[model samples]
Target chain A: MSWRDGIVLSLRSVVRRPARTALTIAAVALGTGLLVALASIAVIAETRVIAQLGKGGPATAITVDANVVDPAQIDSDTPRLGTAKPINAETLRSVKQLPHVSTVTTVQSQDVYVLPPPIGSALSGYTGDDPDRGLARPYSDSAIGIDFKQANNLPITVLAGRLPAEGSTSEVAVTLGYFDHVHLDPNKPAAVLGQVIEIGSPQVSPDGQTIRGRWSRGVIIGVVAQDLGSGGLVTSSTLTNAQRAWQLAGGDGNSFGLPLPASTYSSLVVVADSLDTIHTVRSEITALGFATTAPEHLIASVQRYLQVVDMVLGAIGVIALLIAALGITNALLAAVRERRREIGVLKAIGAHDRDVLRWFLVEALICGVSGGLIGTAFGIATIAVVSHIVNDYLVSQGLLGVDLGGAPVATSLIGVAGAAVLALIAAAWPALRAARLPAREAVGAL
Target chain B: MLGSDAVARGVAVSVRGLQHEYGRGRHAVPVLRGLDFDIEAGSHVALQGPSGAGKSTLLSLLGGLEPIREGEIWIGETRLRGLRRGELAEYRSRVIGFVFQHFGLLDVLTARENVMLALSLAGIPLQQRMRRADEILDDVGLTDRAGHRPQQLSGGEQQRVAIARALSSRPHLLLADEPTGNLDEESAERVLDVLERLRVDNGCTLVVVTHNPMVAARATHRLHLREGRLAPELVGEPA
Candidate 1:
């Protein structure tokens, strides 16, 4: 028989028993829908996490800190009371000369007292010589000093305005965490732009009995998202100038009661030539008597965990599909049993065994195709709704919302094709049974 | 009214020492044991017998519904023995047609679709099979009931639809096993008349398995069976 004829016969047979056919298709649709949704969700999750890590820095970037006596305190931003090999200018030049070391930027961190902008003022928050009396509030925060020209190499996400311009000692950029500290609205970061704030450096009296603040005033030019390290960003020159003023005001200088050395920096951010050389470069830096940390190791660990999640989700989908396949086999078997005489009639009308087999297989294929398409649509809709709900929750928790993109086309195709192949397999035994039935016995003429 | 040149000449049937049995080994019970007979081409033969006379068994072997176990049976130039499963199916489709007592019409199909199904199975194209199905339905006086399913049609109409299906492929040999067995008297008469008219008009060989005297009398010749073999006195006699 021709394939067209076989399809017609099978379609008629399927339509003849609508209830049974619908139920079988529903089972397959549910299985396919669940598989598509779970697989798409896993893919979207991996993309979002990788995107988040990408915002921090390239995998080739590594952080180098002083070799502290306490290993547990390594990479910590807080000052420790231990003699350590400081990351000085000489160390920076040596690391820059090492193989695979592309670039190095020095970083300095220090505690500062910040006075907030006035309630209603122009760009300059100063009302008179006493800018503290015109402030809305006061907050204590740490200031991170780095080369403004190398700011792009560090992990900084600017939400609004621009970063401190190169070599602008009076300019600074606050972090989103700064909003909570100084009672500013983080949702509208632009409102805080162009507002002036004061960074105070403490100085000791001659008798070493009292301390006073020697403040350096600057304007906020931008807002940034927090990264692995704490504190807002300022130019290294600005920090040096503030310390010089405090020292000139009779400060005790360094904690060791010695002159503040311009050669020493708290840490160094080292960039490797490529991701492949990050390990080698970090080891070389450690050999230079420093502790190094690479974000690639953390990213790799996160990817491994996501892979496990993806496998678990995929297995769940496969299990559901297998159960649906069994349902198809059972339904087709019952159809064969009920249509024994009909099969005999077809055979007696001169249908070959393969023709009979094709007829039943076509019926199964129809159900599978229909179910697969419907399931793919369902899965896409589910992903959209789930993404929306999750984004709402994230926004409510004061975190940036994420967008889970559409379902992958290759995944949908695989799901539909898998369903078709499985349906054909499920119908094979029953179709064979129908084809092998004796025409005489089935027609009841024996 | 049906016009198709696919089967222009009727096929003559010859059976020689044909032996068929049920089961295997010691549990075997023989049917159509060593039966030998011949029906001329285009001749209408009535096959009559009492219960357990193996008349249906003979008809089945003749129709290629069952395997020929011992001896050979020939239809035209093709021998039944040693034919593969696919070849036998082809023979059944192209060389012969069968009308069963139960009508054997699929309930899901309309009367016209039932007829078109046979032509479709014979590898006829879609438009041609549809045209042939309508023509055969008209020949059986079921043109108006073409759209009706089996449940909607009476027993006689259903049997006539079966006849239309049997003749859709224009087979050279037509086999009827109690075609009017389930019909009322008037329905049976109408069904018999349609069968006889189609047989004559198409010039195809007709073999009817029946116990009714009226059915036997209408045939050009009659054969009666007793037990597993043909009765001596009723062999090859004019009805």
Candidate 2:
């Protein structure tokens, strides 16, 4: 028979038995939908995790510390005096001129005492009283200073307002950890923006027994996620101005009697041209007598873990499809049994065994393709609803939300093709049984 | 009894020492035992016998539905014994049409689709199959019921639709096994009339197997079987 005739016959047969066909199609759809949904979810999860990691800083960024000459001790943020050569203006210029080195930002930090707004102020309602201090009191904190012109290199997620203005010495951005330390509600961090706080530089008394504060007023412009440095972030000039003011007030040195270096920075953040150049740039920085650390190694470990998760989810989807294929085999076998007489009539009318096989196979193909299309649509809808709910929760928790845009086109096509091939395999035995049936016995003529 | 024009337009059947059996190795039951016969092209013949007399078995062998176990049967220039399974299927499509006693109609199809199925199996294209199906249905007096399914038609109409399906391909031979077995007297007469008219119009050989004498009486020649062989007295007799 012609292919058109086979298609028409198969379609009629499928439509004639509504309940069985519907049940079979529904089984296939559920299986395929689960497969697509799980696969898409895995892809979205991998992308979101990588994006979250990226929020800290570009994977190519390397933190260079002066006291850490060994790469093994790269993570130490504090400077150890007399260990390695300190990074200064010369160090910054030398690192910037290295191959693949895109830019460099100087970092410095100082201990400061912060005094929150008093009761009945704009932020007083959102701030809780410390058990040791009645309402508002000075608390010891650290302010990390970096070049605001190269601020993009910082690993920070701003939760409210903008970063401290490039050249504004009076502006500062506090970390979420600082809000928690100061008894401020991190969940409502926007309330703290625009509030003024007093920052004091520590100085030793002439009697050599007590410490006094050299205070300056600054405005809280933004709240950011915790990163490599703690407390608040400011322009390098801001911390330098505070330190110079303390020195001009007859303070000979810090509480430890160590002189502050006038020309050198505590550390330097070096940005590479791309992730491909991070390792080379880091090695060059380390060769310059400084320790370097980047996030590439951590990213690689995370990727390996996500790949395993993807494989597990894919296995579960394939298992579900196989079960659905079994359902298809069962349904087609029943159809062959019920249509024995019809098959006999067709053979009597000169239909070949191949013709019979083609008709039934066509029926199976229709079911598979229909189920695949429907299941793909169902999977996309499921992802939409799930991402919406998850994003809502993420936003409420004061974090960046995830965007999971349906499965990729290639993934969806593979899923549909997989369903179709499995269905064809499932229908093979039943179609063969129908094709090989003896015409005489099938028509009950003998 | 055959004319030269009918001989030119139809296929003649010759059977020599034909034999067919069911089962094997002592459980064997021979159905057609050394039967010999010749049928002229364009002539209508009837095979009448009691139940289990191998009437339907002989018809199936003639229609190429079963392989010849030990026999030589020829239709036109084609030998049934030498033909392979695929060739026999082609022979059935190109040379013969069949009508069963139960009015073998696929219930899912309309009357027109049922007729078109025969044309389709013959590898006819869709447009021509549709046109030829309509023509044959009209010839069988089923044009008005073309859209109705088998369950919707009466027994007489269903049998007529079967006849239309058989003739839709315009084959050289037509075989019917008890074409009127399930019909009332009037419906049987009507079905027989449509069968005879379409057979003459298509100029094809017609063979009918029936237990009813009324059906046998309508044929130009009759062959009566007893105990798997043609009865001597009724062999080659005119009805």
Candidate 3:
């Protein structure tokens, strides 16, 4: 018969026994739905984590450091030193003029002690300025003195207030942690936008006498934005102002300027032309005798963990699908036994064995596809619900400082396809058996 | 009384020293022994026998649905015993049509669609099937019942649908196994009438297996099966 006729006949055959058809479909749907659900969630989790890791990281920037290094490696042994040699500013100017070298930000870091807690909670040394507060620190990881004009070029997302003006010597944009520590209300404009933080020197001079250093000036030009992450801060201030204060305290103030001969940054941060440039730029930087840090590595580790999670979850989903498949096969086998007479009748009236085969397959396919579609939605809903709980927990813990990750569309599609393929595979044997029975004998069987 | 116009122009079917047995070894049941017969190009014949006399088995052999244990069956020069299942299926689709006692219509299909299936398997083009199916159903006096599934129709209507299906592809031979056995007297009469009409209109060679004397009486030739062998053939007028 023509394909249309075969399909129509198969459809009618299914309709004739509604109860049987429904049971079969339900079995397939359960399997397909469960599979889709797990797969979709896994996909979403992967995409979210990857996106968070900077899937769209920089492409073509070079990183220069004190030593030759593999940019991709995160040295567990090396300490996160507060003080590091700055990449020479003069070299940076020369590098900027290099073809394909678009932009560069010289990063200088030094360990600084700040009391954390309420601004005035404990005068016990520096309570609120606890260095262990992680990214919740009220200052940069190491105190970084930047030329406010050029420092704005660093990849800092200012949450509240505007960028410090290029020539503004008094203004500063603190990391989100500093903003939180300052207890600046986000609803209102940065009330501390133009306020100053006084930096006092504590060390004595080489002359062996306590030196009264002039307090450094800093304007609260910007507040750090909250991201769903644990810790880290990015802040900027005028290099000249910071240098002058350090010099007044008999410290190395010119370290903020062009580094001395043979000097290179202990750590370098480079910006790519676009999101696609992230990896390439990171690599190029690493190739330039500098170590590099990519959120991708962190993201990759998270993804590996998530992949295991998904595999376990997906296995559970597959088990459900397996059960559903068995159910369909069992149901169909039962129907085959019951409908021996019906099969015989069709065969007698010019229905080929293949026609019978097609009928059973069509039934199973319907069950699978429907279940897959429904299950995809089910999976997405599940992720959404769980994500909501995660988001709530984060908010409650006040830990929504950096984004962890999210679900995407590709994951759902994979889930649905996987479910469908499984269902079809499950139904194959039963359909064939039903088709190959001897017409006369099967009819007589009834 | 076999008419040239009733059969296709070639030797339609021949059976020689045919033997058939069921099961094997200790459980073997021999159904036919040295059975021999030749049906010409155009003829309507009836096989009459008591239950277990192997009437159905003989029909199965002739229809190429079963293989003879010994001897040979030739339908239009193709040997039934040597053909593979796929070849047999192709052969059945192109060369033979069948009607069973119980009407054997798929309950899910409307009368017309049941016939359409036969046409489809015969490889008729899609555009031609609808009109062709409708014509056959109308010819069987099932025009009004074309939209009704088998379950919705009476036994006679179902039989008529089966007959329509058998004739839809215009096969050279029509095989009926107790075609009217499941019907009431009136319904059986209607079915038999339809079969007779089909023979005249389509000029098809017809072979029917039945125990009913009335059915045998209606055939141009009557062959009796007793212990799996045909009795001397009897020629008769339409009952």
Candidate 4:
């Protein structure tokens, strides 16, 4: 018979028995939905973990710290000598010109913020700034002076306002904890945008005994999604140190040519051209007498863990689909038996055995495709619900540099198509059984 | 090579030393024993036999449904003995069509769809299949009942639908096991009349396996089967 007639006839046969067909379709759909959910979970976990690691540094970028020689290590009984030397300008210039080093962001200088209601509110009027707020414990954390040229390496999600503008000395994006300590909703970072805060900026001299700079006022412009832990604050890159702090803050407009040297940098963020060469870049930086920090190894471990999870989810989903495929086999087999006389009549009218077989296979295929589509939609809904629970937990745990929200659920089209193909494969046995039945016995008897 | 006029009058069916048996070993029961015959093209021939006389078995072999165990059967230029299993099916689709005694209509299909399905099996295109099907249904006097499924149609109507499907493809041969076997007097007469009209109009070979003397009387020639061997054909007035 013509393929067109075969398909139409198959459709008619399937539609003639609605209850049985629907039952089979529902079974297939259930299995497909489970598969989709599992695949989606694997995708979400891998994406979030990668994003979290990127916050420390881009997966391909390595931050190198200058090595300092301590006198105590040389002479154990000589007591203490001093701290290590920071990476110098010559070393910074050397690493920047390395092969395959696409771009560089020099992280020069670190600042301290006297976080109000600090670690523990003791109501002790230590600063006498807000005496009524006694236990106004002061919070202290390292604020990395960010250079906007390399901001792409940071996995920061802006929750409220924009990031500290490229050249705006007055704008600074602080961590959510800055507002959290004052009992305001830190989640609503936008509310604090343009608000002024008195920052206690105490700088230790080279002798490490003297302090400089009094309380400096800075305005909040952006609120990031995740806390940089030690509550990351990206100060305006234009104002890197106390020397240029006043001028860049738009107060004096002077000292525009002063360069912040790498000697005072907490650490430098160096971006490589590709992830595969991150190890080479790290080793190159180490040869320059500096310790390198890269998240590539940690990310690799997470990827391996996610692979196992995806396999398990895939296994479970496949098991469900196999069971559904069996349902199709059972349903189609019974249908073939019931339509024995019809098969005979068709053969008598000139239907080839292949046509009879194709009709059954096509019927099973229809059931599979319809079920897979419904299951995929069901899986998307499932991801929506599961992600809601997950994102809430991530928020409550104060996780660093990971916001699992905003990314849509990942639906694997191939997974759904696989379910359909598997169902057809399962139906092959019954279709062959129907085809091999003697047309004489099936029709001539009737 | 036969001329066009000779090919037109070429033997429609030729059976030589045809032998068939059932079961095996000690349980073997021989059916047709050394049966031989030649049927001219465009002729109505009826085979009449009592119950268990192997009339249906002979028709089955003629339609290529089964292989002749010890003899050769030729239908026009094609030999049925050497044909592959798939080739047999193709031969049946292109050259042979059957109308069963029990009115073997697919109950799920309407009277019209049954005819259209036959056209489809004949590899007719979709656009013209329905129109041809409707014409055949109209020929079998089932135009008003085209949409009525087999269950909804009466026994006479179902038989007519089957006849319509058997003739819809306009095959080279029409095999009717019992065109009027399951009908009342009036219905049987009407079906027989329709069969004769379609056979004459289409000019295809007609072979009927029947038990009724009246059906045999309507044929141009009648052969009686007794104990697996055909008796002499009783020739009627020449068409």
DockQ for model 1?
0.41
Query: Which of the two, 3 or 4, has more TM-score?
Result: 4
Native contacts retained per candidate? Answer: 0.51, 0.58, 0.33, 0.52
Structural similarity to truth (TM-score) of each candidate: 0.72, 0.80, 0.71, 0.76
Of the candidates numbered 2 and 3, which has the greater DockQ value?
2
DockQ of each: 0.41, 0.52, 0.31, 0.47
By TM-score, the best candidate is: 2
lDDT of 1: 0.77
Ranking by TM-score: 2, 4, 1, 3
Q: RMSD, model 3, all Cα superposed?
A: 7.7
Docking quality band of candidate 4, CAPRI definitions = acceptable
Off by over 4 Å in 2: A42-113, A117-133, A142-176, A179-224, A232-281, A284-290, A382-404, B1-11
Candidate 2 lDDT over residue span B1-239, tens digit each: 22233336553887778898999989999888989887888889999889888888888888888889897778776778877767877888888898888889988889999988888889888899999999988898889999999999999999999999988898888999889988999999999999999899999989999888898988988988887999989887987
What TM-score does prediction 3 earn?
A: 0.71
Question: How would you encode candidate 3's per-residue C-alpha lDDT over B1-239 as one tens digit per residue?
Answer: 22232234455777778998999999999888777667766678888888888888887777766555699887766777887656666677778888877776777778888888888888889769899999988888889999998889998888899889988888888999888888899989988998988887888889988888888778877778888777654423233
Q: Residue-wise lDDT of candidate 2 within A282-335, one digit each (tens)?
A: 778777887766776776677788899999999999899988899899999999
DockQ of 2: 0.52
- Looking at model 3, residue A407 earns an lDDT score of 37
